[model samples]
Each structure stands twice: as structure tokens, then as C-alpha cells.
Target chain A: MSDSKAEASTVPSQKPVPKIKDISLMKAWKDSKAYREYTLFVQSLNRAVHGLKNSDTVPLSPTLDKLIILLNQLDSFIDQCPPKGRSRFGDAGYRDWHGKLEQESQQLLKDALPEQYHNYIEELNGYLCDSFGNSTRLDYGTGHELAFALFMLCLCKIEALTEQDSRAMVLKLFSRYIDLCRKLQRTYYLEPAGSKGQWCLDDYQFLPFLWGSSQLTDDGPIEPKQAIDERFYRDLSNDYLYLGAVKYINEVKTGPFFEHSSTLYDISNVAHWSKLNQGMVKMYHGEVLDKFPIAQHILFGNLISFDPVPKPTGEGLFKKPAPVANQ
Target chain B: MNENSSSNTNGDIDRWLEWIKDCKYLPETDFKQLCTIISDIFFEESNVQPIFSPVTICGDLHGQYYDVQELFRTGGYPPDTQYIFMGDFVDRGYYSLETLTQLLVFKAKWPDRITLLRGNHESRQVTQVYGFYDECMKKYGNANLWRFCCRLFDLMPIGALIDNEVLCIHGGLSPDIGTIDQMRIIERDQEIPHRGGFCDLMWSDPDDIDWWAISPRGAGWLFGEKPTSQFMHNNQLSLICRAHQLVQEGIKFMFDEHLVTVWSAPNYCYRCGNIAAILAFHTATNHETKLFNAVPDNQRVIPSKTTTPYFL
Candidate 1:
């Protein structure tokens, strides 16, 4: 009986061997100690961007040119890291990365903000707290913090552009940001776990901000009402959309979103990535003051609209339809 | 002449005595023995076969004790008919220990009738998370009874074939299980803690949709309609009945009307305001199965009598 079973089990065998490219890719990632290397790369890029912004040797446009180079380098480092198929980092690694990022980002902001803009920085920090801290608030999760940080980065870029040629730079920056946002929005909502068969923003943990026909508007000078509404809406929308997308993706790919094995860091990462995408959209439109009439009315209504009224919560911001392609 | 007559009489007497000595003892004077002999002669008169007239086929009580009693009141008690409790007697409710004890006492009294099977929640890990662990600690002040109950849980049969027609189990079809005997071979001993073992048996959800796959949550895999239809076809079974997910109407039919989920616990944990039901079927005739709501008269308040037996 055993012999018969063994005979039955026997089959012709031809198996493929690992290719040279596969081996080299594995070796490169393994040798690079990608996690630590990526961290260092991010830090260096941050320093390079800051140095270029502060350099006396170059004019504003040339300085931005150097900054763009640094940004490209940062993007390359992220690409090379190759998030897919990497072993999940343990708590220690996560904590180490989180601590380093927090420290570096905080230092960068402190150094970048002028002494006169101390009050503005304080207000920004306070806004961050209000947006991210309140449990009732939509942005009251780790993902919101990441989204806010990404938004800050966009602001920094806008500031840099404004220094060179106020009107042209603003228009250019706004257009680019809007285009990027639209692209990301389409990528996230339409394709959903794109052709690559991977979750778009694995680290985003916030709930999706947009629910049932709501979109952010681009207003000029961030008026008190527009600013408050934008802050609240974006924070909440980002939270809901990011979380919802991740959950949807997880459900399709896995079984359920939140389960025994899911970690806090995993959720946070997905949330952060989602915010980055949304911030990209917001920043893209930040400079394009002419394109969005209604948005302009909501934000800079006193300047643009002859009939100005008290801005109700999300009244004007929600009037414009979401972009068709993104929708 | 006188001597000859006496010898004849004595010889007759001696033959009679020998016959009496050889005979089995029939003690007329021993009252106890005499009583037993008389009782044995009339024993057939008292031999009465208990008639199990009606029984309720309960599915997935799931630690909802209040709901179980509500069911009992609605369905009536056993001995008149028996209860074929289809397992999942613990977990996910505050009163699992009471639920188990009440069912256990009922089973002990009527072992031939009140039957229970092993469910996924009957496992250690499930109990720990759901309510059994806390219930045991609160009731017994120790984990000893919990451990014993878990042992008994292992012995529980995975599936019950009702009158050789209706098949009942806690969960749905598995790729591994083929025959009734295959189910019987499952060792009712300590189960190894793993994904594919007894845990999956109690926890696996069946898919009625086409092209099912493994769930990423690591609990169990999902199935599509094709596999479900094929399973039903191969098994020579009429319907696949299972309970795991919450059913709004205490039952749900899925998979092109092939799969049915019957949840016996209603207003599940006093939340999820759902009506609970039990499936009743007559074996003799291929009559359509009946669904009975075990919900109480007042929907708002859970009756006090329904407090789990372990409390008393």
C-alpha cells in the first residue's frame, strides 16, 4: 500500500531557478538596509532643501531649482526603497523612525519660521492640536497629523514661489498642486488598488474627509470663516476618506480591515499616505485663484464678490462640483 | 407382608425427597426472594416506552440565555418532544456560564433528547475574547469549571443528521469534510490551537456568491456559489443551515436560495434588535421546515426568569 501511494505521488518535475535580476534586486535591498538608508536619505534631502532656500549665492528661481533637485532626490529614495514585499518592521523600528521624523520635522519648522512669524507658527501649531487632538473632530487620528504636515510642506513651496515672482509663482504653484491633486484623487478613488495590485497609500489611517458630494474649495488669503471651515472640513474629510479607502482596499485584498494582527503603525501609515494625496490636491489649487470663482468668493469674497455675507459652515466651499475625472 | 409394605412406602418417600433436592431453590418463606420472583413475573406490565411527541430544533443559542428561555416558553418544554440544540451554546454574551449550565442540567436529565454539538465559540480563544472566560471567573471564582467545560466541548459532535435527512452544524461546508463517518473520526480530545482545526469549524462563514477565496482576517476562507452548490449536490443534502453572522430577521437565506442562516438568540445581547427563530422539521414526511420566533411577549424588557442557571 505504501509503495502504491508513493508511486501515485511521483510526478515529472521541472522548476524554474531565480533570475539574475531577482537576485540583484534582493541583494541591493538587503545590503542597503533600506529602512535606515531611507531614513538618512530623507534627512539629507530636508537639509539640502533648507540650505538651497537660505543660500545667498543663487537667486530665488535658482534656489527653487536646487530645492526641486532635492525633492527629486527624496522621491527617488522613496522609489528605491520599494515598499512592496518588505518585511513589516517591528515596534522598535517604527518608534525609531517616528521619533527621528518628529524631531527633524520639528527642528526644520523652527529653523525655517522667521522670528516675526513666531505668532503664526504658534497659531499653526495650535491649529494642528485643535485639528488632530479633538476626538469629535474628523482629523482626530494619526493620519490627520501627516496630512497637516504635508499641507505645511505645500505652504512652504508656495512661500518659496511667492518670493521669486508673487503673481506668476503663485499661479504656477497652484496649477501644479491642483494637477497633482487631481491625478492622486483619480488614482485613489477610480482605480482603487491600481494595476500594480497594491494599496495606493498603505500608511493612511484617517477616515475619508469627503462624504456624499463634498469637496474643498480654493479661497485666497484664507479668511477667518473660510479658514475655519477648510480646517474642519479637510481634517474630517481626510480622516474619513483615508480610513475608508484603506478599509475598502483591505476588505478587497484581505478579509476585514481591523483584525487581531493589524497594528497601530499600519493604520497610521495608511492614514498619512492618504493625507499626502489629499494635500497634494489642495496645494495644487492653492495658487490657481482665477480658475475657482465660487471658491474665491468663499475665501476672498469681500474682494471678489460684490455681495458679501457671513460665511456659514461649509456653505460656499461645497457649492462647486467635484472634478468629474476625480469624481 | 408388613415389612414389604413399609419398604415400598419408604422407597416412594425417598424418590420424592431426591426430586425435591435436585430442583432449583424456590424459597416461598424468604419474603425478599419471593417478592423479587413475583416482580420479575409482572415486570413487563410496568415497562413503558417514553413517547417523545414534539421537539424543537434549536440553532446557535450563542450564549443568549434570555433568548433561549424566551424560546422555551414559545416552543414549550421537552419530554413531550426533545430539543435538538445545534450547538454554539457559549460566547459573545454576558451569560455563557448560565447558558451552559442550564443546557447541561437539561441534557443530564434527558441525555437521550436534549442534544448539543461543539461550536466555534466552545473553543478556548473564542471564550477568552467573547464572554466565557469572564463568565467563568465571575461565577466559579476560578478557571477550573471553565477548563472542564472546554474539555466537554471537545467531545461535542460537529454535525447532527436529523432522522437521516436534515443535516445540521454550527458552520457550513468544508473542503476537507466528505462523509458523516469523516466527521465522526474527528477526535473529541484537546484540539490543537490553529487556524484550520476546530476553531475554523466553529467560526467559518460560508459564501453563497460565485468564486470564493480565503479571508485575509485569518479566521476562515469564504466560498462562492459554485462550491456551495457543488457541496450540496455532492452531499445529497436538501439544505445547508448555519449560524455565525447576525441575521436581522433571526434568519437569512443566501446563495440563490440554497444556504440558510438560523440564529436562535434574539435581540442579540439586548443590542442588535433582531427577532430570533428555531427551525422545526418532521422527519417522517418531507414537509417544509417551520421557523418559530423564540422572542418573548414584551420585546423591551428581558424577563427576570431568563437569568442564566449558573446564577442560582
Candidate 2:
């Protein structure tokens, strides 16, 4: 190839180049051009999720198998970074643990992605490191969770993850992410950076409920009203993401389910899972996107661009219902 | 408005105590009236009010209204016991409105018995971002009540000096601030600014570093033992008591006990699984500190399916 052709190849026409920058305030996400791009990014996540869910695949997903290995290795470091600090707000070991991950994340991303995507390793590593939590603050919240979700979306964007077995991205890969976050929270006693008591969603998570509700919104007979009924707790939580989140509430908190988890409990009164699903979207936009503290931490990269490029309508995330038979 | 518009008479205070005990909220009009009286009273307080000993210094109520009532039930209610609340009465919880209403009533009724210092969460900008503004709007069906409460927040004192020995503040020290006199000259009675000594007193945190560093919160400095020790030595103070971080044991002593953290919000954010504690200083005896735990959660309220959110 000619020198000019080699140089031109460096700038991929399909993927917009990432605008490298530090963290930004909510204004960047609220302004006209950036807001459109941000909204489009959020919408892109929905579309990518839909693609994965709609794709058909059996067990043994190549993408999840590789990503899970990376996440588990990170989890294994918890033993090395044992909770040794005296202060209960957080353990100093978390910093050590996150530091270890940060040092190896480059190699970890290389190992996780297929050999073909080696070129994207440096760009991808940013999302993975940011997804876990803030190392210095020694805290995790919805912002970190959002970062993790974006990692999976970016995975789909790079085509490292095929449209094959889309649902596993939600059911398997994201499930593993939740498990890892739960372990981090449990091991380090990670404080919720943006917790609003019962006023907000779960301390360390918000996406699971959104995706989980979407996962089972149309899957037969899981009623939203069953949330109020204690009898339904075991059954519903066993099969769906939303109920699983409710089960988590039951685990950590020791008060009346209604009083402590009122936001979710009120959500249960919405009659159907579909409306509840939309409400979850609205709630996420308000609590996670509109809130300055959490949104300010979100960074923009290459795959997730700051350009307002419109796409076809049918490509939305929640467009087609993915089959749950794999689970 | 005039101070008398919502003066806390014995009857009004008794009703507020009842509301707090029941974990119920007052009507918006009643809340506004109480806030007015408290705002008027706060206007009379200095930037750093001087408090004497024999008063209990509690920290970070954060709308754990029942837990606060639990403090009153176990330790003793204000006025009779003499309490100094180191700010952070609202936000990140369910009942910020009720919590402030009850505390303001107590302050209006007996201003000297209770000391209310500002916390990082007290500002209008913060409350709007956190849960308090949403809570007030939803509770009152208007923002007027929230605006009234914000006015009350503006008038709140920044810190307190107990018996001219111990210093009590919501957050840690600042490089911009040298002495207590430097803080006194700061013009208060407005929304907390993005920077300066006023914001640092309410926003900064204590770290184990040697000197002052920028806070991750983007508003104040992350002060260290060097500055804390220097401030205490120069001010001739025995200890600087602060309450911002959620300490697992509810109280943390740093820099060889020269600086202490007292967090009264138990099981912070309803799930921290931590105990809450308050510090009591009996001035007559060289300001010896005594600690009290929160009332064990009894699951007392009959669990009912209500839409209202609850905080620990």
C-alpha cells in the first residue's frame, strides 16, 4: 500500500475519532450539540443491547467467555488486597486492588478481546478501568455502573462481539459485571457516592434493574404488582432482573420493604412491565444523566463519540424482544 | 418575615415532637412557619457561634429523623440536654423536610440549648442536586417550601467554639483559612459559594496527608494533619471536631486525638451497616468526651405498603 493510503487507513471512516479529554460537568451533556451526541450515545446503548438480545446463540459464548475471564481475574485480586484498613468507610486495600487492576488493564483488555482487535486495546482499556469504580475515592456508584455498561456497548461497537448471542451480553456478561461489583462492594465496603437513601435506587447499581425489567417485560406472566406481595418475592426475583434487584434490597436492608425501597415499590404499582420499563428509562435520564455529580464523571471516547450523527429508527435497543431460552 | 410569625411555643414544640416520634411530616404551611422563625433566629447567630460545654455535640443528621429522635430518646432531647448539631440535617434521605422542621422548631424555641452549624449539604445548589429539593417539592406540591428552607440554610452558622477550647465544624480545615477570626469576617447569609473558607468549612474532608490538597469534591481542600495540628496549636484549641465522612464506629480520632470525627447518622444511607455515635463534652471537667450509640432499629413501624420513601 502507498504511504498516503496507510495514513488514510489510520482514520477509520466508520468510527468517529474519540475526543480525548478529562471528566466534564453536566453542562457538556446538556448543551445542544453535546447533549444530542450524549442522548444518541444513550440511545446507541439501547440499540446495541437490542442487537445482542435478538441474536441467536446457544451456550459457550466466545465474547462472554473471554470477558468473564478478565472480570474474574480482577475479582481474584480481592484476596491479595484483603480488607485490612482500620477505617470502615473503606479499606486501603481497595486502592491497592484497583491499582493492581489499573497496572494490568492494558494487558487484560488485550487478553480479553480477540486477537484481531489488538489495535483497539488502548482505547478500550479506559472504559474497563473507569467501570470498576474511582480508585482514589475508593467508592462506586451508578456512574461506574454506567461506564461498565458502556464498555459492553463499545464491545458491540468494535464488532469484537458478533451480533450472534446478543442476549448473553445482558444475561451473561452484564450478570458477571453485577457479580463483580457486588463482590467489590462487599469486600471493600464501598460507600455509595451518590446515594439518596430510599429516595434513589440501589446504592451501587441502577442499570441491572433497567435491563432486568426489559429482559422480562414481555416474558409471559411476571406482574409488576407482585412486588408488593411477599409471596412473589422468591418466585419473581428468581426469574427476572427487576425482582433480583428487589431481592438485593431484601438482603442489605432490614426495614419494611415498602418504606426502605419505596421508589422501587411504587414502581411495582405501575401495572405492567412495559410501562415500568419506560419509567425506568425516564428515571435513569433524571437520576444518572441529569444529576451533575454522577454525569460529570462520564467520559467520551472514540467508539462513543461526541458527534450528533443520526441513525435509522429500527436500530433502537428495545426494538425487538430477544428470546430468554438461553438463560 | 417577623420572628414571631412562627415562634416555637410550648404547644407547637410538643406537636413537632409528636410528629417526629411518629415519623410523620408537618403540613407545608406549618413547615414554612417554623422555617421562618428558625431563619429569623439564625440571623442572630454569628458565623462561628460560641458554645459552652456540658452540651452534646452531634453530627450529620442527614434526614435520619427517627435516628435523631432515637438520639433524643436515649441521650436526651434538646433544650433539656443542650445539643450542638454539627450541621447536615437534610439530603440523601427521605424526610429532610420533617427533620429540618423539627430541628428548627427546637432552635426557635431554645436557641442557646441547640447549636446548628452548616454542612456541605445545606446549600441550595447541593440540595437541588441531592434528594432534599425533590423531596420538598413532592411533599408540598410546590417549591416555595424549599425556597423558604434554603433561606434558613443561608442564615445557619458555619462552625462553633465550645468553651473556647474545642472546635466543631462539619468538614475539615482549609489553607485559605488561618484562624477563627479569619472566618468571622466572611460575609455569610447566602448560598454557599463554589470556593473559599466558607465552602471549605462545610465541604472539605480530613485525609492522612501532611499538608492541604485539593478535595475530590471540587469545592474545598482536603486538609491533613499538618494543617490541623497547626490550626489547633495556633488557635490554642484542644481538639477540632468534625463530621462529614461516615465512620464505621460513628466516631474517628486522628492525629493523636487532636482531631476527631463524630458521625451521628447510623447505618448511613440506610445500608452502611455502621453504628452511629454522638459526642458529649462536659465543660466543667476539662471537656471530657462521652459517646452514645443510636437506638437499635426495632422494625417498630408495622410494615405497610405505602408509597412514601423511608431513611434509616
Q: Where does model 2 exceed 4 Å of error?
A: A1-61, A217-222, A228-231, A235-238, A310-327, B1-18, B216-218, B284-312
Q: Give native contacts recovered, as a fraction, per prediction.
A: 0.00, 0.30
What's each prediction's clash count? 31, 5
Q: Candidate 2 on A1-327: residue-level lDDT in tens?
A: 112223323654342223323245345455423345335444433433431332234354666788889989998888888987646556667899999988998898888777877776666677788888877777788988877776765665566664454556666777778878888887887767767656676777887777766655445545777855668768656455566777777777765555566577666666666666666677887788677677666666555555443354323322133233333
For residue A321, give model 2's deviation from the true position in Å.
Answer: 9.8
Q: What is the DockQ of each candidate?
A: 0.02, 0.38
TM-score of chain B of 2: 0.90
lDDT tens string, model 1, B1-312?
399965764464344333323211112222222223222322221111121324456667766555666677766665555766767787655456556656654454345666666667777766654557655654565676677667666656666665544566676655565555555556545652456545455656765456556643256556667777787676665666676665657667678766767778765533345577776555522423434443443442321211122112
Per-residue lDDT over A219-294 for candidate 1, one digit per residue giving the tens place of the 0 to 100 score = 2122212221334334332222323343333333321221111221122232232333333333223211111211
